[model samples]
Target: MEMIKIENITKTYKMGLIDVHALNDVSFTIKKNEFVSIMGPSGSGKSTLMNIIGCLDTPTSGKYFLDDISVEAMGDNDLAKIRNKKIGFVFQTFNLLPRTDALKNVELPLIYSGVSSKERHRKAKELLTNVGLGDRINHNPSELSGGQRQRVAIARALVNDPAIILADEPTGNLDSKAGEEIMEIFSELHKKGATIILVTHERYVAEFADRIIHLFDGKIVSDENVPKNNREK
Candidate 1:
């Protein structure tokens, strides 16, 4: 089943009178439960593609079918709802609320979805436990280590049971050991049938994915499956 379909997508940015093409006629399809990475150098359009895939930005002219729902024509309100319900984002900085505890942070999404307080607390606790952070559920972001903070972010992302996990430079700020631990969590998530699309410039981080999509000059340069060893590594 194709969870994502991007056809001839293009994105152009206007800087005063100059026009910059961030993506040009890029097209691809991602199946359900697939782990994929988008990699490239600076200004190579990997970020732009990620934004489009996450529904943070729409293409200039193209068709995007996310789980058979047309996203190209969605308004801001509709897109926001889809973002909350269908996509989970993990960022390099963790993006946790500085003053909130881990459990509260994870429950934030449920609040947006209009879930009851009791159910939200239950779900948040379950997710935090699943991510191996149940003991730290009451700790704020500042009280946790880099790895623990990222785990909280991951738990928050999964709180809504989104269709896809969109991670952008998720390990960028962590040390090697911390990064590996986060990747292990991602591996477990994939095993449990999460569709993951990771965007990164590090080969080591990208290697965690089952397939890699290389982007350059606002276009897809290569899309290939990773070897078994690579996937396991």
Candidate 2:
């Protein structure tokens, strides 16, 4: 069961008269329930690749299939539907609404999907509890610790039961302890059968994924499975 498949994908951007190749002939497939990471330095095209995988951007050439559905032809409205139903996103900045409480932030996906108010509330509470934020469900992002805010973000990402979790630099802002905590939560999610694709520049962060795909100069330089001994679990 291939959850993501891309073939010879390319992304080109024009800055005035100059052309920038963000991704060049990249190809890969991620299977259902697999945990994979894309590792690269700044300006190495990892962000561009992440955008394409998350349906936030389209390739200039080649094909993209998300759960066997062709994404190359989807319009903005269609992409929004797929994003709400099939993809969950966690960003380094903890992209939560500052004015909202943790529970409300976590219910965003459900709200977008037209879930009933009562049910969405229940699901948000359950996910917050699962992520160890049960005691702080009513707190605003300002009231929580950095790690706790991220936990809220993780809860929000899972609120709608998305088929894939796309985390971009998810642990980039955290301290060592907090970063490890986030990775532990991700490991737990993978244990429960979620397909995860994370993009990061840190080796330790990338190591949390079962496999690491190294990107350089808009190309895959290496794709290797993590050894059992190297994994956190």
Report the lDDT tens digits of candidate 1 across residue range 75-122: 999999999999999998999999999999999989999999999999
TM-score for each of the candidates: 0.98, 0.98
Local lDDT at 36 for model 2: 99
User: On a 0 to 100 scale, what is the lDDT of residue 6 in model 2?
Assistant: 95
Quantify all predictions' global Cα lDDT against the true fold.
0.93, 0.93
Segments of candidate 1 deviating more than 4 angstroms: none
Model 2, TM vs. native? 0.98
Residue ranges of candidate 2 with Cα displaced over 4 Å: none
For every candidate structure, what is the RMSD over all alpha carbons to the true structure, in angstroms? Answer: 0.8, 0.9
**lDDT tens per residue, model 2, 1-233:** 99999999999999999999999999999999999999988888999999999999989998999999999879999999999998999999999999899999999999989999999999999999999999999999999988999999999888888889999988888988999999999999999999999999898888888999999999999999998788955
